[model samples]
Target: MAEGVGRGEILLRPLPCRAPPPDGAPVTGTLRLLLGDQLTRSITALDGLDPANDVVVMAEVQAEASYVRHHKQKIAFLFSAMRHFAAALEAEGVRVDYVRHDAPGNPGSLDGVVAAAVARHGPAHLVMTEPGEWRVRQMMEEWRETLPVPVHIRPDTRFVASHDDFADWARGRRQFRMEFFYREMRRKTGLLMADDAPAGGQWNFDAENRKRLPEGERLPDRRRFPPDAVTREVIALVERSFPDHFGTLEGFGWGVTREDALAALDDFIAYGLPRFGDYQDAMKAGADFLFHGLISPYLNAGLLTPLEVCRRAEAAWAEGHAPLNAVEGFIRQIIGWREFVRGLYWHEMPDYAATNHFDAHRPLPAFYWTGETDMACLAAVVDVTRRTAYAHHIQRLMVTGNFALLAGIAPREIEEWYLAVYADAYEWVELPNVHGM
Candidate 1:
């Protein structure tokens, strides 16, 4: 374990730190807030600010971890990401009031944290990026109605399609299919179509993307970003605080900064995109990554946007750097299924979580947590998930989700695992994919 930090301790293992603002410069206003999957950049709150008078507040709340028995890497990922982001804000000359999970006198829940921050800081107003989960949104609504200061919730701009846009698309529809919505998005965005026609002759190359690897086939080594000091600190904290949780820190390699995330994206574009379309859905023994883009963490954290990623993939296609199938397949992931799932979540949620359409009731097998299953495919996928807190879409849907479906594991139980393990999981994107798709 890394030295010094522990659960809930406000240990500032600086990624890149800023010298404190000129000593004794009179403190003025502060804004209490929350940052989970949607709320990333400080600009979501900072852009409307009088920085000379406003300080931005963010916290690593214990309620998040305790709400579900989260996978260890998932807990480590969020806490580390938040710490890195907080450091970035401080570097930009923004005053940040950060509450660490293990800090003394810290509140375990967002409600308590925000209330305490407001009581002490007394800002003129509270601003936040609207949360993606119904429960969090409800809490925020309650706080807005009752809190001392006026709370301002801003719409997230990370996605290409808005909540209203998705609702409008679903109007008068009886059955919702992602392909139809994706075609509309393609036309609206001019992604892979030329004059409203698919760039080649096909709208989807999924037929070509599903071929599995032949036995004993060697996969090119998956690229990984080395953990920075901040991530190391967070890993130490997880080791000390969550010894019983699933997952290990031995091979903890994740990007902690925006620059590292960008690098990871470029690496995928160069090394993986050519084969991404061909094996995008393939599963095999010991092969965890099959040419999948690993930028979900950055995208989920607001470090990157769907538009920017799509634009880059499109640009790669335009330049002949990658083939149409590969580029289109990757683009579809972001603009296609990603948006569709979010819409389905918002459309059916609160109820969606309870819709055990198949009514699966068996407990999730013990090996899901231990990755000790006898099935080769499942063991490989779960092992990778336990170590990295990540698995590409196919691994998630077909392998793990398929096993859960076969074993009759409760949808709620399976949903909890998906939500708890992946860095990209937010209720809006995670729920519909797990429960319905």
Candidate 2:
């Protein structure tokens, strides 16, 4: 996808095509619950899965999409991705009981949906990857009330940092900042490292990466994924379900499968990475992407792994296709800042969400929703966000996010706004970026 997620060609795929298990497969295995973000099959929760006896439950209930009044594009992207993942599992001989948003008498919550699945399948137990959001995890904690079986929540291994590992790194530190943490991550992953040293003898080159897009420099044509049958259907459903949502449902181009995500990565490295380090922090009036990789959504989703993305950048540097600054900066975000944020998020929560170090108290202005502000930069960023559900990091941090903080808007309100609008926002990732900042 473009920065946020930019252009890509839509590779349409229907639900799984493989035949189901034997006509009378025994219902002996525990039911596996899959959330919208946990779309990969490599999840620990699915290890040793039994296609003959176990059932996989994936749902698109109204409760989630409506929980924050998410952008119509975000809702459509997740639902469409979930459907494709479920279908892929069914093709692999796993029995998947997918509940649609429009399913009759849908209970609207994960607990409610899982309980319904239990009644239909009569599984002995439930297995799930730990959810990303604290609020959702709180609900999972009380599942015994709704489910007849015991529930087991496994750690999500998609991230390089586990809860314990992150806590260990942060323990007994008097003053915490990302630079030291990032250095340790570079050592831990061996990314852009040589013989126990950073490849460039520097931890970060961000200071040198502040150049603006030069005048008359043209941007690469963005990769746009035209919606196919499945995506078109999802777009229509989102339009009907979220008529009042903030952003437009038209021009939806996010990649919903593993192949599409890989294609997105290739496109970025080919055209974006060379210039990314030079102008990463620069902003143009109407350019939403510039040289940034819009692969964060794919990375956050199970479609692509963070470590792998970093390795790709490292490889680009090693092969001399990209400068060390460019490669190191990109890798640092994936392995360093991203991991640090998630670690801080888990270590500091269920109190993190309530953090307001500045004690700010104000409302997010109406301009955020309408992109009608007088500031040229802000209005342009908001206009792009309204159309694409994305704005580059500068637009987010220096424009809208900065305005909210300077105006003393409540953290919770702004957090909700970010969560509602970005296609890549999940509480685990979005809350830390918002509240911790």
Candidate 3:
């Protein structure tokens, strides 16, 4: 564990510090753009990049921060994580050009920043992994034509399937259920696969994983991290700048670095994973995170990869620390529902954004904003979301999302609500869950 720092006792094992990259070195290679979500070193944008010659650009732009009414805690977590990632890259002798959102005379857009970087460094080309949203991809297309250097948009290789691979898988299928897709992913990753068969003789344990919380059952101790110096600075900024946002910044304990994320994963494996499936669908009045690994924020932010998380769960099963039902269910979520939703979003987007098969056209009820409904379940989950910017999948789907769909709420309105409220809300994942499934 690292030092116990900031508001509360958060024992975070900090990544080893290295000397920062010096300036005025001759720039001879590509200038790669790293989005806030794309913080990993293994991303294709930095492939074959020379730390001495190449430059990496990361920014906190106002346009993205204010694109929607994001929870104040959500903004603080992402901004702090991005800052830490840039510092980590710079310490590894790579030149990082980090632009702050409040920088003097800074342009409020990513393309504008890229244009300035090109003028300053004069790189051979610009490289980036494919962006998470269709909107950003369109922006990149315009940049390719106008920028001084050739722009390369590489495939984001973090997933088991590429866009082309998913397109191929989806071509002739009339009905796109997640089970068939998940089986293929299982085969591809060889996760829980025992040669020609699945481990423990089943492909899915979903039926076995749906037990509710019994009368007085217990949940293991949840690991919480206190905001470090970088995080504290971000929290202060968010509190000052966006005080009226949807959520509070009081319990801001997400792990912003890879080491902290791994520690969270370890905590889940030891405490949460064993009982995860048993209570995967459980929802008591006051219980917020019951046996669920609340690591989606880190997973979405690129600090923790989906594959790695799934692998850890499978390892727990193999070592007999957790049962097969729990491990399989957890793995299925990462390789199954998560990947399927992303593929569906990308495959059907631009048009997918317009999906309203049910023709539900009611405005979101006032209770969604204030959690003031007479319904105890609805009010409880919304209160949790308001305070922590988190609710388990069941609360999101069954309680909140179900209410929206049943009342015939406008799809876009609810879409933005899910996007703005959750810590793990991103278009690639959130849209399909809201509009399609």
Candidate 4:
């Protein structure tokens, strides 16, 4: 059993076969299938869960972790977070059918484990939030046909904009631009909007956000969460299972739980957000994290919601805790670029992955994986990526991605590299960003 996992939570031992209640005593339980990314407690799938009969099924399968040679820390962070989330659910008396990757008879794939859980629980229905990737969405559709019970794939409500909203905004437009979509989201969410106009009398502050860091400027200290026992176990598991994966786990400091994520958010808003805009695009040697909010992984993984993050930043600006430029830029990232890419991904996926406008077919350079290059910019970004599995947008777009594009590296190869290396690299976000690049 995983550390802190309560009794009856681990599904290793065979559960007693639940006999049909006499004359339909209430209804059978709803089986909730929570993917690794759907760790939020209030996710739509769990909205009306009844602890008495409902069972939440979560699995740390090998397939997802090994799909693209994910960063070791990435794997560890997810597993640790999932485990923590399961434990928290169990503490609330929610029955969690948790499966560890190394558990005996582990099927090693999401569909397999979910099927096993269904067979064991004999649920009346299976519920899950919509997946983030096109391939996973296809798998969910397959589950609808294959599973014995009804499968409900609810829309993920954590995002600011829905798929329909994006589609409506994109309809009949020859060119899809994020600026307009962002303005719509601002109006829709009423974020940074005053009555009918945008805050600061403008919709964008990119012009004011490009100042280079002044010489010898003191950077704020970032909050780091040293590995606790749960995370340490996950680290050990990842190190033992994935010795050949990219990136190191030596200095793994990411917060895995919701509390930790909130603390990191507060830390960023208090210290980093004030100076975030000025040097968000600046890169300096020996400064891997310069005033940038290191909360993308948390946000992407559902520990933080997009609207809540944007609202907090907006509040910071309103309360004079951070400047308008910094707050607006940060909010734009969450509500604007993040939502826009997600919209683009779902809108054009299954075919979007095949669209390579450049038609470049050169192989990705060896140094993208090894960081063994002489070019200062490329080497620095790759080095940071290898050590931390993180690089700000500018580092991704301007440095590594630019090098790949200029060198005519195959889009698929570079796209796979981005997905494999970054902790926050999911297909919906990474693919669109790579395509845009």
Candidate 5:
């Protein structure tokens, strides 16, 4: 029964294998699990990848996609980006077990996928970088007792700030504001400050960034990364699968590959950075993107690290090509407020989601789906969101989210819409920003 017919001959074995005894089974190999957001090359789990023994398991689980009625483009972005990453790993001769959404007996969630992969591979240990969402982390921990392998969740190396470091800075603080944290970050990273002090004797140049669109000030032509074959396929699949979902795919111009994301970052540095600070908080009626860096999609999807972005802004500052406020405001967003909000999210999650300060429980307006709002600003942002699946911070915070907050839209409902629409609206960042900011 064990003998093969010939060299290179195909062999079919019985499907069922006897389950080994729970306590006596030996741990044989290592399994590294990567969630969708952990798509960057700088992750720690890939440091010691051995093509012969190690298996990298990445899955497109239904739990993630169905958590909210995700936008057609958002789903396409994550799945398409993940597939691209998997292909890159395979090109590097790295062994990868990618679980597609349509695979038979597919796990409905990440937990189920991890269990199946561990059982199939019979690995000794499970390695992964820490997940951003608390719920995901809890499920992952629960899998440790259920799975036969020891799970080791390592700190994500993508962020410049550490949990312990951020906690220490926040210790004994009264009100946890992003401004104070931004200053500390400026000192720690030496990003846009002179001798641990904010440049130009001001911590924030937000006043400079709040200029509304002048009556005749016309915006230059916006930049975009045209869709490639993979993205086009993804758009078609999304249109077919999620016909009822909001958002248009006709103008779906996003960077699907890492190289494209880098090009986008460079373009923003050269063109967008000069006016980014000036218009960071401004909103215009028909302008989709007004002097804003459209790099959030890259930053949120793990294609670009926050540290690298801050460094780029710093380089611009050193060259005196951009003003202190512009460079500083942009850098603080990457290094300061982003991390501060993330820390707050982790510290108060599962409870924070339930907070309704204004007791808003209204359904998201129907206009959010169709971009049919009376206000010209909402119309513009929503139209852009529908077409491109991308919106700058002002559009998100002031135009869309601000309207939701002012109109007393339910936090949960608003969160769902934001999560569904924007390519960069992941739970970790979107939740707090929607809830409080």
Candidate 6:
């Protein structure tokens, strides 16, 4: 067994130490608050925005970045994406009040920065899409009561199902199984549906998607987005500000803009989807991503919406570009598993985070962070995670997650590691996944 470390005892590389309030100006029309994840242009918070009088607030704050010692690449990706999104809004004549994480007199927290923006712009109301995580939602609720202006928390329309929609489906049910929810989503969206029936006359092809990789099986060359000028600058900032954070920024190829994210989606549909189903669950030596759609980070970051991605996959199937099994499996992941977990999160949070069903209390092993271990599968997954800040679902579930479970690692410790290590991980998604495992 690997040596265990105490909770919050993970060593760091050591970094420089690092905020305040502002004065009030005349009240304006609205002050829109855009979190890093709320990068979509058509988000409800930006609805009916007035460029002349209203201002949008986007910030890179210390409190969010250091909340769990996030991966360096994850920080760079979000910060760069936020910067690009802000610039896009500015180009469209929307006035944006952006706060850099390294800017002088930064408030260093989401609420603090929003308060400062309220004082400076003095808007009549604050508008924002509801946050994904329960903790952040609680913070927004506090803002509603404490802020001097009215706050309008809009539903994040990017998701296929709203919280109420999920709650309605989950109401009085004895169990919350994803397969049943997935069928309902299929019926609701009419994706791969034929009149009143599923396209393949079935709800799931998951059993067909579990084949192991044959000898010398070929893989697609996944697209990589080279960091542009804005991304480069953000990378430098993260390197300087968070020298102690996990994961390296060496091979950081994730797209940091909407356009780049779309390109990635197209690339996956063309090259990765056809083979994705057969080998999505198959793991091989030295193959980090085998026919996997490497777009989760983009999806989670709001660069790509779940509905659009599912539609594209459906289109590929209709156009005969990919097989039905692959398309169905991919769609299920987004609309079925992804949506179900999100709904379950909102349904059971604030209590769910503390539910340790197995009561596993072993500390996380040091190899999880360093990838130094005799177990090849665990070592490989951790190594790739440290280098690229990514791992496919199977690798996460079967290797690292499985090891933690069997070794009896504490749920909170492993949960923190999952949240800290992956670019796509957020509390809303990560907590449910880790808790389930």
Off by over 4 Å in 1: 1-32, 214-218
Better by lDDT, candidate 6 or 1: 6
* Candidate maximizing TM-score: 4
Q: How many residue pairs clash in each candidate?
A: 6, 12, 2, 0, 1, 0
Per-model C-alpha lDDT, please? 0.74, 0.79, 0.82, 0.86, 0.75, 0.85
Residue-level lDDT of model 6, residues 275-355, one tens digit each, is 898888999988989899999988988889998999999999999999899999999999998998999999998999999
Tens digits of per-residue lDDT, candidate 3, 1-437, equal: 00001110111122222233356543246778888888788988888778867778777776777778888878888888888887888789977777776666457677777787677667777888888888888888899889867788998888878888799999999999899999999999999999979999999998888786788897687898899999998898778777778888998888889899999999999999999988898787778898999899888888899899999998999999999999999998999999999888889989999979999899988788799999899899889998888888999999989988888999999998888888888889888998765
Give the higher-TM-score candidate: 2 or 6: 6
Give per-model CA RMSD: 5.8, 5.9, 6.7, 3.2, 6.3, 7.8
Candidate 5 backbone collisions, by pair: 248-386
Q: How many backbone clashes does candidate 4 have?
A: 0
Candidate 6 global TM-score = 0.93
lDDT of 2 by residue, 398-432 (tens): 88888888889999999989888888877777788
- Report the lDDT tens digits of candidate 4 across residue range 394-428: 89999998998899998999999989898888899
Write candidate 1's Cα lDDT for 1-437 as tens digits: 00000222433222222223355553235473647453356436555555556666677777777577677776777777777776776777766678876788777778887787677666666777777788887888899778887777877666667788899999999989899999888988888878979888878887777776667655667668677787888888888987887777888777766777788888888878877887787876666676788898778777777877888888888998888888988999989999888777777767777887777799988888877767887888887887788898888888888888888998888888787777677677777887766
Specify the poorest-scoring 10-residue window by lDDT in model 3. 1-10
Compare the candidates by lDDT and give the number of the best one: 4
| Sliding window of 10 residues with minimal summed lDDT for model 4 | 1-10
Instruction: Judge candidate 3 at residue 338 and give its lDDT.
Output: 90
Off by over 4 Å in 6: 1-28
Task: Give the winner by lDDT: 5 or 6.
Answer: 6
